[model samples]
Target chain A: MFDINKRPEVIQLSHGGGGKEMNKLIKSLFFSAFNNPILNNDEDAARLHLNGDIAFTTDSFTVSPLFFAGGDIGKLAIAGTVNDLAMMGAKPEYLSCSFIIEEGFEVGKLKKVVDSMVNEMDKSGAKIVCGDTKVVPKGCADGLLINTSGIGRIQFDGVSVTNIKLGDVIIVSRDIGRHGAAILMERESLALETTLTSDCATLWPTVKHLIEAKLEIHAMRDATRGGVSAVLNEWAMGSNVGITVKESAIPVCDEVKGMCELYGFEPFDLANEGTFLIALPEDEAIKALDIMHEFGCEATAAIIGRVSEDRPGKVILKTPWGSRRYLDLPQGELLPRIC
Target chain B: MFDINKRPEVIQLSHGGGGKEMNKLIKSLFFSAFNNPILNNDEDAARLHLNGDIAFTTDSFTVSPLFFAGGDIGKLAIAGTVNDLAMMGAKPEYLSCSFIIEEGFEVGKLKKVVDSMVNEMDKSGAKIVCGDTKVVPKGCADGLLINTSGIGRIQFDGVSVTNIKLGDVIIVSRDIGRHGAAILMERESLALETTLTSDCATLWPTVKHLIEAKLEIHAMRDATRGGVSAVLNEWAMGSNVGITVKESAIPVCDEVKGMCELYGFEPFDLANEGTFLIALPEDEAIKALDIMHEFGCEATAAIIGRVSEDRPGKVILKTPWGSRRYLDLPQGELLPRIC
Candidate 1:
């Protein structure tokens, strides 16, 4: 219930000078949002009690248009790193957040971003245990950039890209390309009459359910920047197996489909934040889909493809026209700062 | 041993697009520089074996000049986070690095920065277990910003800012203000013909020696952005004790002194990267000093101050002219983008 509006209107250089202003900002803003014992210690580092196999990951969110359709950089920062741990079959536990804010940025927007981060952390039960803030002079940086590093305890073993096998089937957690399309619309200032939103959400709930169901998942990856095409290509190469993806089975919402067609882009190449691809045995595909559905995954979760022995180290796309083509790794920059 | 000279000339948007070009840049540049078993897995997150109490910390390096007199941003990124863990009496083990690069940045310069990071990590025996890279459009960001979040096992316990007691003496590891002075000179293009280098180093070796020597250190901290004055003031307020400092006892290099005089700056208010402050029993000061000296700490290490019961929650400076003054936390921005 901290009234962030009452603080300074804009961040000052002194706020990051590591002096009284910096300390005041840290305590009043960051400490208020991420209230916890470990963070409140005010020590140079957070003392954490961690055990067993742990997963560590880091991401820097420079997504432009900080405020997008469904989320902002703060929410993406938390969900992005948490999803990485969740994909590794780890329970998201602790995270370290660092922000590089441009001076003159509004403090209210920062508070909103922090609020969104807090909301997202609630989904995975992750805690922001340690954080650092730096404010650069105006023009030295964009409005804001967030870097989050997470540590999680591995609960399930043997989940990796190299573990994908020929008999495994690929499952899409939800509709694809919403994140990219949404950002595209926001950035382009498209006035299309559509209720399209970015699929920026935490995947830990669905991932947890899959884990709790005892499904033998071989590999899991969120379609972030390069979308499904990049994930499929990496899996095929890493496992030394062929991945036959049914292009028609891939779920792309109507708005995203229209956006891709208009922009001469492929849906498979568009990014997604919440949607993910799961590789598992064919027998577990149905159960995985069921669990995903039970968790309100928007009824878009479906079996999108299957792994095979032929064409090792390649991903083959079976088009709706009954033709096939190589789904190569994305070649050029589809979108800069797309998350 | 990697031939970094063979890489692309400049980083393009495709290098951070999460596609083929991005993959190539990562494999050729990052993978080669930070080769480790855990990082080579190519998983969404790095799998690590961690146990017991661990220290976690994060820092973002936005130093104005990418390269400085004695080090660069990469070195500061590693040493800064590693020093935080070391200050908490932890054995630096794993680190996560994330980079935000501006498009059109020279790849050769990036390679040199990476090399500096590798060299700095060697001092702490820390591995880059996981990392992320993002490229922002030109004009969105400066050349580069590196965020390093570190994890370490707590080797020594009970090192807290609140542990400072009235009977403890304060010791500084080496001469201060060189880092701030070096950056100031670089930014202002000063033509001072002096060998004033930044004290940018990894402090794990010195801290490790102190712990091994069985010194009952109560509190330890690196004088970073806010400098020695900030550390002392924070210590006093955190522990609810008074601190009396002999201003003449502080170690300041002649070059730094000259710069301070010319710039009308206080040496104690300037920053230091490698220098640190330690509080221990007054009787054990000599033993701690001996260990520091034997471990190659420069002869500048000295007892600069002590804790006191009078003037609680304040810092008193004993000037050379038989006068006393209160040294409050630095009020304004001394220097921005200073580590």
Candidate 2:
């Protein structure tokens, strides 16, 4: 007997209040989408059965525009935290999501975002077992912000930045900077004919495939925020080893490259939500790429660099002209609220 | 070689850009305050050892006027989620906090908040194992919002809203409405000579003591938004039993009473961050109150109501003059962002 016409079209402060309205909103909207035994229990907290070593990670998605070409904030929120656990060789399992939404936000938009989250969760078989929702007065916040914290049982062990050794091959999962480019395009309201989209996707499927294949992954990290440059620089300093990358070998889509040229930015320093880097023995690179290609969202995985013993604690970029230079970590603000 | 004077006085967008500056801020501020081995690992996720049945909860704190009497948002963020687990008779163990800070906020204020979080965590022996920080442009958000998600091992079983039965005595932890009144005072810049402060504090100690005392607690919940009125209504509906409250037996401070009188608010409908309500067999009320009095933040615990089978799914309020009325769940917005 639930009527769509009876529901409020836009969110209100009362929806965040811990009373009848809040309960009705939760039961009708949130419960129907994220319905599960644990969440259905009208308790203050969700009870879970967890054993052995678990991986825990958290991320807050404040991506502007709320929605982009390939994804929205909800999809990015789920994928971002799930990728963190997957990078640690963990089986993405239980997740906790909290939303700080602005009052007067369209209810239809909220439902769309939640539906996107449910769709993304299916990729990794993760469940949103616990969540919190708070509605801020309009003008106090932009629109909506999501914080997703995940807990997963570690399925594979010994994956660490310090584990990267000399002769390790570095692999990039796909072409870089699509997520950043997509956001930039949406923000600038570009009307290009290209079918460019944000590369926001769940990486657990590919990670699970690699784990099942028993590839020895030394280090794995998604190139987010500061992008590939930041990840490489951290890896170099963390392992006290030098990394040499061929600039020409690094994958970059034409749309991202074009956007970078237009904005005077570097593709390697641009963020990517779905792209990840892996370091393993040189001999295992082919097998890992094959497994990733079969299960990854995109089939553009490539070997972009390698770990070296020379010039420790630095990342060397070798240009197509055979000139070598140090690649430093990204400095200053590139794009704020780019997720 | 970390120089305090060398750091930026205010948080810049660069500090959350996931680059060198972001690394420095995290290592210098967050790491120094929440130092732990698991966090120092610097992996994408923190590896943890967990066993048995655990409780998981999430909460987002967006209380206006970040600093209030008796507590701040940082303290409330930790205590709020910890209380949820504690309410379920769980031992608060691991927490993951995410921050969405506005650009140009003072770094000094941020540090003070982080320090407050550390102090609050000490009360419950909970550690923040993983976290994420995001910075939005100025005007995109109001100062700061924190999301804290917690995991705790359940030490006591079968404490739930559905567990309340007939003859169960309901107990109020302490004087209510302080948190709401304090926030209202701060927001309104009230200069009353009353020493009214929020009742925000970690409830894990009291919950732990009760668990150790082996009290067969049926249902426990912190009276947050909508206060004791919300908890009683939900319990009545959830357990299919009627709740009868002696309005005169409830404890309310003079300051809160005055504020409610001025604002035309009901004390039962105001929020309390630290105050809690418990339902158990009448025979165990004395022992439970004794244990709570010894370890709880306040000693004003009182038996305010009882469970009955007369009017299922409803709450009855008995006035001092032998008048009775139905106390329904709060409607409309009592107060937004009270947490």
Candidate 3:
């Protein structure tokens, strides 16, 4: 039923049936893109050979517009899961990809999304070992939503929010808020001449490098939804320590700043994808920053803050003008589906 | 921001913002239902200590009319993933649940779904250790979709589709096609004064019994979408063998048979949730049937077929009247969102 030349331009309900058409579509598209012996086995579940401690995580990507400046939903799906593993100081291994596709969605578009997923997966060296596809009736769903659950081998121990200690330095991996700004711009149909794009990329490559270097990492987290403000606040509260962030060192590109100004949003309240925060000893901060620079994060990665014992469970942001304010955790909704 | 006295009747975008409101929703709802020390740790990813061969699988449930007969989407989501692990001869252990919910959805309904999930998970003893929740703007999604990814420890080996050898006995654990019929009746608003419900129950309890008994399980599969026909065809093709099913031996209740007849559907092509098929050696067929009987499948469980060497890669059905015909795989879409 899924003849290469005679396939439906738009997906039909039958394509999701656990029958011949579904088999053909899976074998021709998903299987080919995520080709692997474990996946090719075609069993009810994928058999995995795992040892030691493992990290388990799950996320569902329902980003609106599907296609964004630097990546599509598919790309976001893979990077998002892989990044979680990276933040846990784990080497991302097997991933399960599931998609809930809306009826009438174009097969061509689906192919493009799957391709983006494959390309993004290559950056993290993780393979999608098993997947499930379900098609909903028209008007029952909007476009497609992807869910990716990851299993990774823990490469190092003691990387946790609770591990942040006094004198531990906090580093912002790169410029923040691009993912949020890019999505807002695309939604508003801004035709600016500037080449702005979402900072969405797989972070495992850099995390792997840092792990191999053994720089004594305490905690790491991507500045995703609710941005750095949320991550900093949680660390301070969870670790029972205070954080002092030098406002000037927190990178915010001109594009993001402009969007924030135009939209009455704070840069700290924006979301990010590729950017991350690292917490380690003060002496190792320099080493971590150097490694980040070597990974092409130069001029962006900076020692932004430090952990303090004073005023536990608080985050203070010192402004460039010599003033300070409590960087409270984000409240209410800034933007939905900005991931 | 989350005042216990001022909770909104419906979910707001702030609930998924990764901030105070999101934290409150997670703590008040999800955390309380799937309460466990590992989940309460609140790390970016759940740290799990896993060893030996494991089974990893993922599924996204987008069943239309989130509440169905006998089970809601939440129960289905948990049972579906746990069943996949059970089929793989694995012990259901940990799961990561992610929700893509539409904005303005009822908070009360969400609680109901979550409660149903907890109840169903109790049957499998799998703990949900981590989860992600995303709220999409109204109209961007339909109701809610759940993605559950699971990791389980494999207990036995040699359980595969390709392992179905000649002289294997095929057995159906229970009456088939109830799930598909229930969904269809609901969609069509048929007031058939009959007690027809979706066969959506946690199958791990029954599967666990079989595994513990150590009866050779060549291959086992739950008859979900595309029904038993799909499973049979896949087994035939994958094992490079022939299967002959006796039409009279497959169990079907009176109500289900009536609904299928009215809808002009073949019961074998309809979906099921809790029902499953097992392929074992002919010598162990009686033992397997007895185990199923002890597990409360006595009236429904039946040895419906046998694997054969003739007509490799195909399935034949012997009718009650002694006629025989090829039981081809279900083709095209039988019913969208059957599961």
Candidate 4:
């Protein structure tokens, strides 16, 4: 008769104080959400296998409002770090979290955020090992900032951006910019009604599936800050190849598209927390799409474009109206603190 | 010829951008301040040998005002991380820095702060290994936050709090809480005319000398955020032992004492960025003090207290009138974000 689902939504200081409340929060939320062997062990640090090649990624979250419409800073922090590791075709195993908190910020709010982070990490099957906390005076900082660094084993041997070729097909994981749109909607006073939930979920399993399928994955990049346009532009520049995409093939949820239109924002340049741009050989594109779809990320998986040999280091979009336009790299951060 | 000594004091972002101004700042200020072989190499990451044992430490700086009365956030970040490794009797080696910058911050101010950090690392003989930079939107964060994590090798065996004993003598590195006083003075605008500088510096060399001299250093701790009183209380409680200290034997600079008196604060309860406490066997106390002094540390190191068996898990301070009073652990943060 615990009525566990009726738990408090706010965070508290004691949740981080390594006391009874901390234990309860970890057990009820984190362990339940991210039940894995390494995390379930409940050790200060996870013992990782050191034999394979390693991929390391670190990201810091300074999301305003701490908690947003669909997700909070805690979930974003874990998801962002895990996705960074996943983008490298690595199986994320361990993570280190550090918190910089402002004084007078509700302790209960922090607990809620931390609990959300734990749940996200559990869902992703990544263990939180080792953490440090520092408190600053009130008004000295925004409510809270979380820094997370993850280390994972690079299971694939020949995965590199250099492997990208002229005719490789580009496949997107899901709809774009849901996370950014949700955050913007929460921040502004626009009376927009839509079911635009944040696309904040772990992509490790999908990444693992693609790797296991023996698909010739040439390159992969997460559409985080600056969105798919930024990531595709970087890939084109890095690989010294040109890319062309069919604008109609790109998936955009109706709710997100409507929100972007209302806000005078382009979905292509907005941020996406859970989407990834994958480059693979044309022969393997269909099979890879099938594998990703099997992981319940089906609606938005599509062969949006292909690498080209004619023009180098440029991205072109074939518009829905039969006109070709060059997709330029993002000039500056579109939605700052989107991640 | 450039008058390097007359250069402006404010920091600039270009200093961290790996450009001409950054090089000049490094050579003029950092290289001139701390001349060391490893630091002068100027590689992207420092490469070193891991001979015997190792210890690691990391700390982040997000102080409200980048530049404080006595020291800036940059100096504090370097010293804080270095001291954590030193407290474990480890020889500090390589350090990694990551910056979370807020957009629209003045570039010149960031340069001065980075120059200070590089100088501190050079003085500490720790090399900059890896670094990362992420920019957040203006107003989403305070000016800048720096996260520095480092790896150090433990030079000696049996150097930990677990080795502490009932009758061991306690020795302090120097004055207790000048750093905290300077920060408070900057914030609260106390009209105390005192030239108090923060005691923030690298302590690895001093610790190394003690370990090399084969002094019986049972335990060591850097009295930082929670202050000397908090650290001592934790040590006593952790070891299930009692501690007794004579107030007269402790070192406190006249300026800091005056400031503390004016502010109605106890020097014992305030934080110290550079000071450390060592629990040593009574017989080896002098040799340990001698080694610390030879390393250019405060030469006025004193034996302030002794560990005791009676009244376990409690700390007492002996007053000038021969009365003993309980020194309870600090229940809350005294000076948040001191480091």
Considering every candidate listed, which one attains the maximal DockQ?
A: 1
- Per residue, candidate 4 scores C-alpha lDDT tens digits across A78-112 of 98888877877788767766677765566577768
Question: Native-contact fraction for each model?
Answer: 0.91, 0.92, 0.93, 0.08
Better of 1 and 4 by lDDT: 1
Distance from true position, residue B6, model 4, in Å?
A: 21
Candidate 2 chain A least-lDDT 10 residues:
A292-301
Model 2: lDDT equals: 0.92
Candidate 3: tens digits of C-alpha lDDT, residues B84-167: 999999999999999988899999999999999999989989999999999988888887889998988898877899999999
lDDT of model 4 at residue A193?
Answer: 68
Q: Say which candidate scores most in lDDT.
A: 1
Q: Which residue pairs does candidate 2 place in steric collision?
A: none
How much lDDT does each candidate structure score? 0.93, 0.92, 0.91, 0.72
Model 3, position A254: C-alpha lDDT score: 93
DockQ of 4: 0.17
Best-to-worst ranking by lDDT: 1, 2, 3, 4
lDDT of 3 by residue, A100-195 (tens): 888899999999999999999888789999999999888877888889999899998788888899999999989888999999999999998767
Give lDDT: candidate 3, residue B250. Answer: 94
> Which should have the higher lDDT, number 3 or number 4?
3
Give lDDT tens digits, candidate 4, residues B120-205. 87766776544445556555567789887665666665655556797899999998888888888777766767678788778877
User: What's the chain B TM-score of candidate 1?
Assistant: 0.97
Candidate 3 chain B, poorest ten consecutive residues by summed lDDT: B291-300
Give the interface RMSD values of the models in order.
0.7, 0.8, 0.9, 6.5
All DockQ scores: 0.87, 0.86, 0.84, 0.17
TM-score of 4: 0.82
